[model samples]
Target: MEDIMRGRFSRSMITVAVAAAAVSAVLSVSITRTLGQAPAARPARVGGKPNFSGIWQANNEANWDLQAHAALPAAVTQPGIYPYDYARVPAAPVLALGAAGAVPGSLGVVQGDGQIPYKPEALLIKKQNAEHWIDRDPELKCYLPGIPRAMYMPYPFQITQGTDKIHIAYEFSNTARTIHLDKVAGPPDDTWMGHSVGRWDGDTLVVDVLICATHNLLKLFRFGWSPQRA
Candidate 1:
């Protein structure tokens, strides 16, 4: 690429991040610090098992690894192995930068939604990700939605436990997992969430998983691939 074109693209990224930040600030202020009310505790059933239900949040940075903070990088480039045409990646045209400016890139940028501030190398990898996110994002292809990916999906899921079974329902694609609480005790087979084993210890719910790969189903099924296809 010519020096002039590189400058234009870099500037464009800055502008995009700035504008997104302003709008995000407004949206955050509207939320109350905490829920206004809490439910009263209920007594345990005959078996002394407690019911686990109600709104809960899983707090983790896994969702925003790429958008941890708003900061300019030493360099931002696309990943090498991902599919899709790099030139086709989406980037808004250039504009001004402000402390309140929206961080450039995609998905997580707003005011507080600034750049993900990935480690230097990770940022470069994700920068490559930015280039083809529309097509290459595994979630879009119906893949497993990977760790942290599945956790942060826009939809809500529920977990229900019974004496013999435990059920988890995912909002995306209506994906669900059913665990045999009775311990069928059989040889392992591969599945999306792999096989889950669950038990309760006082107030905590324990989940054990294995043999899972990929967040989207389409990709994990493939054992081999063409070089060009990648």
Candidate 2:
């Protein structure tokens, strides 16, 4: 009886050792395979700067108006009869579209006091442009939206960052601009997209822009002014 008990204990010890060895071998193989593979790639960077290479878009009513406003029945409206006697209606051009031509309300993107600090004279021109928006807005005419306007239009844009230059392409009118990080000659003539010179301010990118003559022309007809910087 003592010999049989000892034999049984020996067999149990051997079985436990074999199972442990099998598990150890499987883990060793897994670890070896993991270490042999290449490391995963990281996001692109230039000189320790963040990569801005991606498609981006703005989802807001900034394109409609930068100032806060209430929802309106239409983009254009005419006078209605005396106090509570009559309701306002859409103007001739957009009347056919009904609610489709209405302007949605926005909280406005302006930073301070929710008002654009327009010069008195410039403010008059702004009012006129608002009144004649349908006829004068450059977007309606499919013109290349310039500068900041291009940045916020309801469309997608792409940014490709490089060692010394960043390229931005806008879906609107296929417009594109290059932001130069290195010193370079300015454009011979003012361009629709303007000349953009850039520098990194810590992690932020500051850009200085000089607009084309066409932008000033548009200001008189459509947009207020060409942005000087972004």
By lDDT, the best candidate is 2
**Best of the candidates, TM-score:** 2
TM match of model 1 to true structure: 0.44
Model 2 C-alpha lDDT per residue in residues 17-115, reported as the tens digit of each score? 999999999999999999999975647777789889888999987877788877777777776664441366677887887876777889998897997
- TM-scores, all candidates, are 0.44, 0.72
In model 1, how large is the Cα lDDT of residue 48? 59
Task: Please list the residue runs of candidate 2 whose C-alpha ends up more than 4 Å from where it truly belongs after superposition.
Answer: 1-44, 81-87, 97-100, 214-223, 226-230
Cα deviation of 85, candidate 1, in Å:
22
Give the range of the ten consecutive residues with the poorest summed lDDT in model 1. Answer: 221-230
